[model samples]
Target: MLIIEGAGRWTTPTDGANDWVEHLRMPDLSVGTYCIPAGGLDDQSPHTEDEIYVVTAGQARIVTPDGATEVGPGSVIFVPAGEEHRFDEVTEDLALLVIFGPAYGSRAPAHPAPLRPRS
Candidate 1:
């Protein structure tokens, strides 16, 4: 059995430092906490694996190639593999639970499939 304590896993971003703190890692998936202070920048690039983000606190707007969406606590969002996305305009201290399928950085560096336009 695997157990993760959320209280111990939570972390805040320091100046010029990464905001993600991974907690669990398995062959099928990986979990982590991502926190960004108000007005902080999310300088992450597209991932090779599909990702889901569950907003646990604060407010922000996620921008993608397709469009943008406002998010707040309890909001859940999904980003397909190789799609460009990032969070911006954080009005408050944003915290989220991030889940990656097939484990983060576990895939080969080969070219990923292009993202289809959402209907």
Candidate 2:
């Protein structure tokens, strides 16, 4: 059995560095902690694998191509692979438990399709 401790140690960004500390990795899944300081920007791009985010602390708004939602402690969110999303307008330090299916970065990055003229 595998075990991890102090998963919440990095609940807030340190020295202005947004941190993502991976704790567990397997063939089918992976887990980690993501911390962004209040007012910090989330510049992460869409991943090739599906993701689940569990808000452990703090508050923020996650904006996706479809819509946006407010997240706080105990909030659980799911994002599909290749979807555009980001967290913004953070009102407090944000800490989240992130899980990726098929393991994070296990798949090749998706390329944007060439635009086609309207028929």
- Top-scoring candidate (lDDT): 2
Estimate, for each residue in 1-119, the C-alpha lDDT of model 1 and write its tens digit.
87777922336777745488888999999998988888888899899899999998889999999999999988999999999999999988888899999899888576779999999
* Model 2 Cα lDDT, one tens digit per residue, 46-87: 998999998988999999999999999989999999999999
Query: What is the model-wide C-alpha lDDT for candidate 2?
Result: 0.89
Superpose all Cα atoms of candidate 2 onto the true structure and report the RMSD in Å to 1 decimal: 7.4
Best candidate according to TM-score: 2
On the 0 to 100 scale, the lDDT of residue 56 in model 1 is 88
TM-score for each of the candidates: 0.84, 0.85
Q: Write down the TM-score for model 2.
A: 0.85
After superposition, which runs of candidate 2 have C-alpha atoms over 4 Å from their true positions? 109-119
Worst 10 residues of 2 by lDDT: 5-14
Clashing pairs in 2: none
lDDT of 1: 0.86
How does residue 3 of candidate 1 score in lDDT?
A: 72
